[model samples]
Each structure stands twice: as structure tokens, then as C-alpha cells.
Target: MTGLVVPAAARVLSARELRALAEVAERERLGWNANDMSLDEEVLFFLLPYSYEAQPMPLWKCRVIAVSGGLPVEIGEGKRIRFGRLDVSLTTFRRLPVASRKAERQLLHWLAWEAAVASWRSVDEDR
Candidate 1:
């Protein structure tokens, strides 16, 4: 029997996305229980919006692995890629709550705000 293999190009959430996800976890008060079942479940819950036809397992697994290192992984190449994508995506206004669009823009904005704050705090702590 062979196990399913996901390609490297498979869409894993970038670091910024993961940080935004961590913000969702933090907002839900799940940050303190890093390795708990409830925290894992909550993370899955946030990913629900991005799911297709109720099958979010693959994407969820990828994201969970990326974020498992910590709430805010060091800002690096992945973060640069995430920000670049956001820059391109925010150039136009779009409707939301509809099946196709969902609330992706709002979610991204919120995540960006959270990531900024987290970055600032990390910098402050270094001083």
C-alpha cells in the first residue's frame, strides 16, 4: 500500500499566513496551550473558511506543520513571499461573503495587523 504524497508545490500557507492564523489562535485564547487538542482543533476551525467542499484536511495539515514551530516564526523568505502576494491582491476591491470570494480580504487585513503588532513586540523584546 502506498501513502498519498503531496507535492512540494502544494499550497502551504506562507509564514505571514501562519502568523495570521496564530493571531486567530491567540484571539481565541488558544496561544497558551500550544500542544493541546483544543488548540489544534481551533486552528483547524479558522482554516474552515478556505476549505473546499468540506475537505480541508490536506491544507490544514500543511499549515499546522508550518505553524508548529511557533506563533511567529522568524521573518524571512516565506514572509517576503506572503507580503508580496498580499500587495498584488489588495489592488482592487471585491465583494465578499459570497461562495466564491468568501471573506478573504477581511481575514488578510486582520492577519496583517496582527502580524505587524507581533513583529513590533518581538523587536521591542530584543532591546
Candidate 2:
């Protein structure tokens, strides 16, 4: 939605989309822009989207997060990648939800505003 235009913005999001966009406006007011959050707090801020036909957050999806995730994780060969205390497989990570619908819709909306500026990150090199 940022780089490319979609054919039509649907009426279905009249409430949802407007609210989410408004929140994007309110990010600084919400302390979302605060730089003092702990590592765990940042982790919690991730994964607030997906799951009617899907998934939660930390329990199942912590791995794929390392891929395309906001933070850096040490990655190496073999099936499992060690991240902190947990070792997770590449297969498991890819299967996890980027967002979980089971989460409050408000949270899902809020997470969309993650402020990190995008830069070129090659997965092979990052890994």
C-alpha cells in the first residue's frame, strides 16, 4: 500500500482504516516513539496482527521474526537458529504469522506504524 497503489480502497475499512491512519498520526503522543523501551518491550510490540484462520505472538511466531524482523538475531547453518534461549527452525519461522488477528484489532492497527525506516537488508548477509 505504501509503494504501489491498489485498484480501490474499500468501504469495508471506513472505520478500521481511518482509525489506524489516525493512530499513525498519534504515534508520538502514544509513546510508541519513545526510545527507552526494553528489548522485551520491543519484542512484545511485534506480532500484533493475523489469525482468524491463523496464530498468537511470542509462543509460535518468534522464529520467522528473525527473518524480516526488526531486530537482529544470530543466524547460521543447520535446521535451527539460536535466538537468545530459544532455538527455532527456518521452517517454523516462515510458517508463523506476521500478525495475529486474535490480538486486539487496535494493537494490530498500532503495530502497522512501526517507525523504523526501511533500509537495504539482504537476508543472506544479515543471516
What is the C-alpha lDDT profile of model 2 across 42-120, one tens digit per residue?
A: 2433321121112222222121111122233346521211121122223433443344344334332333433221222
Q: lDDT for each of the candidates?
A: 0.32, 0.27
List ranges where model 1 is wrong by over 4 Å. Answer: 1-44, 48-102
TM-score of each: 0.29, 0.20
Q: Positional deviation of 90 in candidate 2, in angstroms?
A: 16
Candidate 2, after superposition: displacement of residue 105 in Å? 0.8
lDDT of 1 by residue, 36-122 (tens): 323332221123222112131112222222123323335561321112111101111021112123333434544676689889999
Q: What is the model-wide C-alpha lDDT for candidate 1?
A: 0.32
Q: Considering every candidate listed, which one attains the maximal lDDT?
A: 1
lDDT over C-alpha atoms for residue 27 of model 1: 60
Which regions of candidate 2 fall more than 4 Å away from where they truly are?
A: 1-34, 41-43, 47-96, 104-127
